[model samples]
Target: MNPNPVVAIAGATGAVGVEMIRCLEERNFPVKELKLLASARSAGKTMKFRGKDIVVEELTEASFKGVDIAFFSAGGGISRKFAQAVKEAGAVMIDNSSAYRMDPNVPLVIPEINPEAALHHNGIIANPNCSTIIAITPLWPIHKVNRVKRLVAATYQAASGAGAAAMEELEQATRAFLSGEPFEQKIIPHPYPFNVFSHNSNVDPETGYNEEELKMVKETKKIFGDDNIRVTATCVRVPVLRAHSEALDFECENPITPKEVRDILAKAPGVKIVDDVSANYFPMPKDASGKDDILVGRIRQDISDPSGRSIAMFVAGDQLLKGAALNAVQIGELLVR
Candidate 1:
């Protein structure tokens, strides 16, 4: 990799793609050149990077030429279509889609957790699912200390996970609801004004788990490199516009205390402690939006477990940043180093 690499952002005009641009600039990533690639519909549009407007180009197989590092925020289909081209062009692709996450050859990486896994990538490194990243970021510290045995998570996902269009639909639906005007939701499956629904991903008939929930379970084990860890999740799509919140309950291999958990997280990279019981304030989506650190609070020992090995906590993180763009950028930073 070049000391200053030419970075290409696939799907540059989308929500996560836009945040990728911001992260690269805010973090002062050593970018030699920036190429913005999107569908033909978004081509010719200009997006700002380092006080300059870079024109968006139609993505093609030829787009990876001269690109040393490619950040892909496009959907799985697009990532799959151009992956070989990126490999052939000799660019390292840090993909933000689920397309290659589970592939044995590709590494699913969260820089804070398992950065060393990224160095062995064949050509593409996959960013974990948004909900998976949020739940696991704080857990990695705890798992390292106590060896998590089981983890159950309920995610409060925002519209941003769906896409930029879904976020716009959420805002529009809220306005229509307030005005008592009939509105049709086009992006999301359910009404987004002030409603919550099960994640829209298709559910498995045998297991009754949606695609999002399955990703959490499988990705957790894969990223942690511990298939023995038990995991389950119920993913919900809330009306929030950005950031994702999660309620996590986990049991460690040995007895663990809340204070011990707090101590571990205090030193964990990419985590912020927000556990203040008296003031009744904990991690909230409003406070977490736009922040790179995952806010964690509500730390307590689970009363249900008499054995004293279980703990509970609540966490929030910007779905588009740490969950997607910033994570990909962090991986890029690792490669450049």
Candidate 2:
């Protein structure tokens, strides 16, 4: 194997940033040197990596100087401002923001399905939206054999996708609601504690779907290499802290039965079939939290379209793992290799 490259992390103190560090250590990615970069406000913070205290440095255009790979979990504005600079400095960028996702030149990647596309990157590789990532990992294997024709999905997302502040907001709001306070809500437009609502992004007038839903439909189709698949999604913000769960109803070109779907997904990489409804053993947010694999459960025949080609299932995955940081790091691994 080629020698490990010097890796740098932008937004080193954020939620996904912390998980990125853990994932790097967990997967034992070749790392000759590790650099942690964050905002000027977080410059003096100290974070442990591989048993060593790694000091956080303020991210600058010059931060990519000796770095060969940079994983960016910063917001879109920071990514738009600095990603190209990092790339120009000779480091490949794996960005975890929506900034470059829709760019025709930038590949929105899911390694399980499209690792090959990472090689064609000019500078940055885009990580798909969190909800989309969790959904597609399990959906792709079935799509490969049966070919999904259309889907109607409803997402139950955790607070982590909105970042650390949002997680904190949910917590604080929950406490406030329990204590009979006004139940202040800001990170999410609706009351988050014990309540679920549509995604906060602006709604599309025609489809009435939020931006997150649109991303799921568009990104899923792109990552699966199928433009003909029609997907309509309703992304919801729920009280869960980590895993994102989706109730998916799929119409496939090839006929599909529950047993075949189970068998196909059971052998699929990056997926775990947890569908035993009689035992209440299907995927749950709490059980799926902190794990990398997407869990599928509650499998059944869709009554509306019981043609054997149409089916419904539920899936849950760690939004921060397979959805964001891990996927970005996997892209980096693919690029470096």
Candidate 3:
């Protein structure tokens, strides 16, 4: 690889797309040439990178030519359509869509838990679902120490996970509620202000859980290299704009305590512990947003269960950064070296 490798950012104007750009710059990724590609609607718009205003180009087969790495956040449809083409263009793709996540050949990486897996990319590596990535960031380190057995989790995801339009819808609905005006809804199936809805979209006729929930259960086991780890989940969409939170009730193979969990997480890379029960210092959406580290708090032992064998905690991370943008950038960083 060259000292400054060329990189392309597909869907460079969307919510996660914009965050990808910032993350690459923040991390000081060596960018000899930065190409921002989007759909025809977004082409011709300009984005500044490395002190120059780079024009957003319409994505085509040629978009990835001469590109060293491509960070994709467009959508599953776009990824399914052009991901292979990007690879054929001789660039490695770090895709943020679910299209290739379950592919046996593609590595669904969190960087914190499985940096080694990033080396096995077959041109396109998948970023795990946002909720699963954050939960595993704190849990994987512990799982390595005390093997996770049966797991149950519920996610409190934010509107930003759905993209910028959903965030705007939440804001509009909240303002409309306060002003005694009619609430409008379109981006999401349900109204967004001060409300919660099942995050599952288009129910799976057999399981009843939404595709997102199913992804969490399956991806967790796959990423951890444990098909035998029993898991179940309930994913819910919350009105928050940025961070995605998860409440995990996991029973491990060994007895685990709050202090031991804190000790392990405090030293894990990309994990920030905030578990102080006396002052009620815990991780929150506002506190986690715009940050790179996953925050874990509300640490306590789950009673009615065997001591040192079970623990319950809350984890939060920026869905746009570590969840999507930062993860993809880190993949590129690892790929270059």
The candidate that wins on lDDT is 1
- Which order, best to worst by lDDT? 1, 2, 3
Of 1 and 3, the candidate ahead on TM-score is 1
Collision count of model 3: 2
Query: Residue by residue across 1-337, what tens digits does model 2's lDDT show?
Result: 2258899999989999999999999999889998999999999899999999999999999999978888999998999999778878888888999899989898989999999888888888899999998888988888888898999999999999889989999999999989998866777788899999888888999988889999998998778878899999988889989889999999999788888889989898889999776788889889888898999988887778756789899999999999998898888789767
Query: lDDT (CA) for every model shown?
Result: 0.96, 0.89, 0.88
* Candidate 3 global TM-score: 0.97
Q: Lowest-scoring 10 consecutive residues by lDDT in candidate 2?
A: 1-10
The list of candidate 3 runs beyond 4 A from truth reads 1-3
Q: What TM-score do all the candidates reach, one by one?
A: 0.99, 0.97, 0.97
- Which pairs clash in model 1? none
TM-score of 2: 0.97
For candidate 1, report its TM-score: 0.99
> What stretches of model 2 exceed 4 Å from their correct place?
none
Candidate ranking under TM-score, highest first, comes to 1, 3, 2
Q: Of models 1 and 2, which has the larger TM-score?
A: 1
Tens digits of per-residue lDDT for model 3 on 45-157?
99988678999999998888899888889899999899878878888888999999999999988777787898888888999889888888888888999998978899999
Q: Root-mean-square deviation of each candidate, in angstroms? A: 0.5, 1.4, 1.2
